[model samples]
Target: MSIKVGVIGAGGMAQYHIAGFKQAGAQIVAIADLNEAAAQAAAQKYGVAKAYGSIETMFAELPDLDAVTIIVPNKFHAPLAIQALEAGKHVFCEKPPAIDAAGVQQMKDAAEKAGKTLMFNFNNRARPESFAMKAYAEDGTIGRINSAQAKWIRRTGIPGFGGWFTNKDLAGGGPLIDLLHMVDLAMYLMDYPEPAYVLGQTFSDFIDDKNFKGPWGIPDAGGPTNVEAAAHGFVTFKSGQTLNLQVSWAELVKREEVSVVFQGTGAGGKIERLFGTDGLDETSIDSCELYTQEGGNSVNRSIVTEPCEDMGRSRSAANFIYTITGEEKPLNTPDQALSLMKVIDALYESAKSGKPVAC
Candidate 1:
């Protein structure tokens, strides 16, 4: 049986989800957004049967929807997921799952009560390069991971400086949340370590420098901004593994880059560069070079590329439907998302207190 789906929000990301669902064989039954016209336009473009101005109305009209994709802004993620689960529909929500820890818990509770699947759209995990790295780490090819480093830097890429992207109340934090995919990927590759402590610092000096490049298409001289343009954090996991994270939007450099390095006791490997949704046309490197001391000689082994399943936004949406139909497990469960949010919360707390926060 084909799963019935509804999509909320008609933003840029929404199109990705709509296309993904269509490819996955799910029926786009309804679409809703605050802007009725935008919703109608998306419905027409995606061949959805119904369009509404709000989720409540859509749910009322399309009660048979097997799942709904919540593609709204960061703040609305939790509430929308909870509502969908309560209405007996599985939820595929965008990342950061919630704005804070409390919000994360509420969504988890809602899913538990409804006995429905709730997933966060951590699409980076679907990348072929990410899968290769995971396989290398899991196969003991990298030995016991001792330390890890991840970096996400952009030359001058501030988003919506005076709009919701820069608004603390709307988007939560700046690069911390905006570029959290790298952070989540690092943590996930490291076996989802429980941070024993976190020491972090955030900076917003560039946002007010009057020389930053805004990615959200917002003009300068609009108004004041209230979000960080760069952030860094040091985390010590309960297993004694350590991770260093660095992210930025308004850096004094060129090119947008993402990479992660893992140091193991016997050998170490690093992923130099990996393309994401931001640039699908670009070629991706799914290979890693490992260095090890074997038989008193420095041995370097280069693992070549292996075929991997593409689990982009569409694949994730399809997985949501499969999980709802009991054909597969959710790509990202509520518990896993809540854990990621907890790490995010700890990073912020540590930044504010100027000390290490225990997870």
Candidate 2:
């Protein structure tokens, strides 16, 4: 039986997600967005059965929505996910999980109470380069990870300046949440360790400056301009592992970077996804390399990786359906997402206090 999925939010992210579900052979039965035109347009484009202006109305009318993909803004993640879970629908939420730790915890509790699956859309982890590196760590080739460095730096690329993306209250934080995919992939490659503390610094120099912004998202001017444009932080895991993270939305760098390099006791590995000068689409090359010793001599090996398992976004939809149908165990569980949220919460708190914060 094909699973019936109702997608919420009809933005660029939602387009990828809907295509993924369709490619996975799941029926995109309905869609809902605050913008009615967006909802209707997405529904028509994807051949969805119905479109609604709100999730409440969609759920009330369509009583058999098996799952929902929540791709709205950061602020709606918790409330919307909880609502869907309570309505007896499995929730597939986007990255960062929620605005803060408490909000994420509420989503987790609601999922548990409703006995529904709550999964995060950490699709980058499903990329070929990333999963290949993950295999090495799981196989213990990169034994007992001690330290790692990761960066997802974008030069002059802040999303929706003066809008929710640059508003602390609306977006939770800036680059910390916006470009979290890099660190999330790093943590996934390291097997999801429990973070013990975080020390972070955030800068908001270009929040109101259009010169250092991109032309991707719709700008909502006249909103708050009080969020960081970049963030640098380090997390100490309870298992004595550490990771350094540097992410930015605005900078003067020559190029953009989305990369992570892990150093461990046995071997080291790296995953890099590069973009062009314009930073619109990813460049053709992505590298996944492993460093180890062969016959007592050091060797740097390039791991051969295929394209992302079901194309770019389909893997996430496939994995979620597998979880629903008991074919595969969920990799992005609510507990795992909550762990990431704890680290995020600590990072913000540490930035505010100018001191290390316990997760």
Candidate 3:
């Protein structure tokens, strides 16, 4: 039987979820959102069978739904995911799992209690380079990664001056939370060691500058920008592993760059994406390479893979479908999301207190 799925949120992100679920042979049965008109429009556009104003209505009406894909804001992730899990459905949610660690823990507990699969769209892990890197790491080609540097920085790339992306309550803490893929990728490459402590600082130099807005077409929502424009942090793990993070929506930089660099005992590797036009993925170049000492001589070898257009957004969503069907394991677990959120929480706290915070 085909897996039946419902998508929450009629926003742009939901379109990716709908397409990906369909690509994996799941039947998209319904589209649900707070705005009935938007939900109806999305359902009609996608040729889905139903549209509703709320997930409660969708769940009440479609009892046979096998799963739900959540593309809502960071604030609603935990509540909606728990609701779906309690109603007997697997969940695939967009990241930064929730507004904070406590919310993520609640969602994790709900999924465990319900015995349902809960996965997040840590899409970078589904990229071809990431797949190859995982193989290298598992086979000890990269050996044990002791330290890593993760970055997603841009020169003039704030989503908008006053949109939800800049609003702390609706979107969490700007680029540190929004562009967290590289950080998560770094930790994933390190096998997700338990974080012990974090020291961090944030800057709001360009938070209110319209000149620093990104090239993406998100319109200004006309509100105060309370979040940081950039953040830098370092983390220490219980296993003696460490990670450095540098993320920003807007900063005085050369160009937009997304990358993760790790130093392992046997080899060091880097995965990077450089954008010709900031905030535009289509105008970007992706590269992966490894640095090692071969026969007492330094060697830098480039690892090639098929080009990725969406950075594994659709592929990661499809992985969720495959996981529930017993065909593949999920790319990310709820526990990992919880752990990542704890680190983020500690970083924000540390930034506020101007001191290191324990995770």
Q: Which candidate wins on lDDT?
A: 3
Assess the local accuracy of residue 35 in candidate 3 as a C-alpha lDDT between 0 and 100: 94
Residue-level lDDT tens digits of model 2 in 180-238: 88788788877889999999988877767788777577666778878887889999998
Q: Residues 95-200, candidate 3, lDDT per residue (tens digit)?
A: 9899999999999999999999999999999999999998899999999999999999998998886777888998888999999999999999999999999999
lDDT score, candidate 3, position 33? 93
Quote the positional error of residue 48 for candidate 1 in Å.
1.9
* lDDT of candidate 1 at residue 262, scale 0 to 100: 79
Q: Which digits, one per residue and each the tens of the lDDT, describe model 1 over residues 3-119?
A: 788888887777767766776678888989999999999888877788999999998887788888887768888888888888998888887788887898998899889887788
Residue 337's lDDT in candidate 1: 74
Off by over 4 Å in 3: none
Q: Each model's TM-score, in the order given?
A: 0.89, 0.95, 0.98
Q: If the candidates were sorted by their TM-score against the true structure, best first, what order would they fall in?
A: 3, 2, 1
Worst 10 residues of 2 by lDDT: 276-285
Stretches of candidate 1 exceeding 4 Å from the true structure: 214-224, 274-289, 293-311
**How many steric overlaps are in each model, in order?**
0, 0, 0
Q: Clash number for model 1?
A: 0
Better of 1 and 3 by TM-score: 3
